[model samples]
Target: MSQLFARVVRQAIATFDRKNVASFNKNFSVLKQLVDQLTPCDINLNMDLTTDEAFSRVGKAPVTYVNLMEDEEFEFSVFILRSGFTMPLHDHPVMHGILKVMSGSAMIESFTKEEATGSAGQQLLYDPDAVRIEVVQDEPRLCTNNDESVVLTPTKRNYHEITAVGGVAAFFDILSPPYDSNIPFYGRRKCSYYRVIPRNGESGKRTLERIPPPRDFYCDRGNYEPPDFLRA
Candidate 1:
């Protein structure tokens, strides 16, 4: 890893202790400083694939980060997405996370989990208008050169989608304990899904559109292939 990459990873991991929420909150200031100190002109876009397993398959991968402490308290990673790439909408079963854009920009859309209406083996109907619905209006906001970072928690912020726009975009992500799939999504309580609607028919003003009946939608997994790095 590069020296600078090593430094940031080390700093992130150092801030993972239980008594560091205050410190972690404060770290953004320092993170901003680091961002200011970096010039896109000086940073090399990491196009190398040999460094990561996921990336090796695609020829380019998001930057790799090692969360020094990997437990329920916190987890961290460096994300590098190519222009036009999209990480689909999904939920972190039980987690909170932060996204700090390192370079370029992205359009992130997030959905608040809400009550579901449906039966087993049937399509789940997500409340289009639920009191608990919240979306990242400015999230997926255009972040470049150390603007305010995006923070997400399982309760306040979850079910977000990320798309890279313009050039390649990189960000530092911190999630608590990572993700596990065994947990269910609707109990004392479980997670729910919701859709968005224009609250006032305004250009961009949106509200959750509660689904009266259950429906189904396809989840896009994305299509990425390895470029011909070894073409004859």
Candidate 2:
């Protein structure tokens, strides 16, 4: 890892190990600052992967997860997005995280649940017009090579999707209390997909909603080639 990336992991530890909510919240911006300092080379990303090669393995492997640091407090990984690909909107269970663009650019649209949707596997009918919803990041802010960061929490913009721009894009992702069942505290990190539903004839920002996302997409897990300092 580079000195800058090491700094990010250090602060990430401090932020997740915080004893109280206020303390954790206070350290968020601090961690964000550290994440803002990362670059594509820090994680040894494959800058040469073409859009054709990337989308080729869509259901097989749409993104690459490069592990950096993993412990009790938090887990850090670099998620590389392929060209012309979009990570469909999804939820983060009860965890908190940070997304910092490490290379290329991305358009991120985030949202929060206006009403309780209950646990996964439960089926329910929904009325688009009746459900209360809000567009937290309406315009899908552009993020390029650590230029900006998006903070996520259980109550905040917990559900969102990301679209790669200008060929390929990647980000340094930090998640607290990782998605595990044994090390349970903030509940298991369960992920549920959702499909965005537009209101009536209006489109864009007029009104929007997210229903349980379809399960047609798929991907394969691959290993991360760590940098010199991050090598096991």
Candidate 3:
């Protein structure tokens, strides 16, 4: 199975064509077929997580990275998540993507930006006032060991966040034109951010409950602070 995945990775990289998006479209099934062969039951498929320590706290956040053929219209990255991990609601600029949970269950939330407003504009660098957020999809979706994957793109379900709900969840992802700088994170009804929001009690679990969804519809502001360990 590793050999097959390796071959598919190579094929994905080789198929990168800057001028034509169809190059990737033509080879899409190759990737789909390759990932189908992997199952959560196979421990050999565990992802190596030495690099992404910020996400390590949730458990292993192993990722398979691929380089695009310069000028290629699209590229791909695949990930293997341990039982309690998540990739929170985030956005990518001028690009589209997909996440097909190969096994287990996933809690996914999809959002779109709302127009900017009032104090939100002054407080946010991206004219937080200019941003508005809405929830498009939020639910626990079952992804069996060999089922169809989720699809994401600029046109389809474009912005979303995902969490591993059952055991480990593995997914295949595709992004077009690669990731650019203009992606955003949730701040309004679109998603929630983790901060030291005041809690009613000292209990660690209690803090989790006091947190509220982003009320201003903000996403991906570079000036935010993450957990200390995630700092590089």
RMSD to native for every prediction? 10.3, 5.9, 12.2
TM-score of 3: 0.48
Write down the TM-score of every candidate: 0.49, 0.74, 0.48
Off by over 4 Å in 2: 18-22, 48-60, 115-137, 181-186, 200-216, 221-223, 227-232
lDDT of 2 by residue, 47-152 (tens): 5442446556535466766676788777887777777678888766666888988777888888754444536744222222333344343456888874767888
Give Cα-based local distance difference scores for all models: 0.49, 0.66, 0.44
Give the better candidate number (2 or 3) by lDDT: 2
Deviation in Å, model 1, residue 135 alpha carbon: 5.4
Best by TM-score: 2
For 103-222, candidate 3 gives per-residue lDDT tens digits of 556666554332234564532222223233332332445565556666554433445656766465556566654543233452222223432222344332111111345443222211
Ranking by TM-score: 2, 1, 3
Residue-level lDDT for 137 in candidate 3: 39
Predicted model with the maximum lDDT? 2
True-vs-predicted CA distance for residue 35, candidate 1, Å: 7.7
Ranking by lDDT: 2, 1, 3
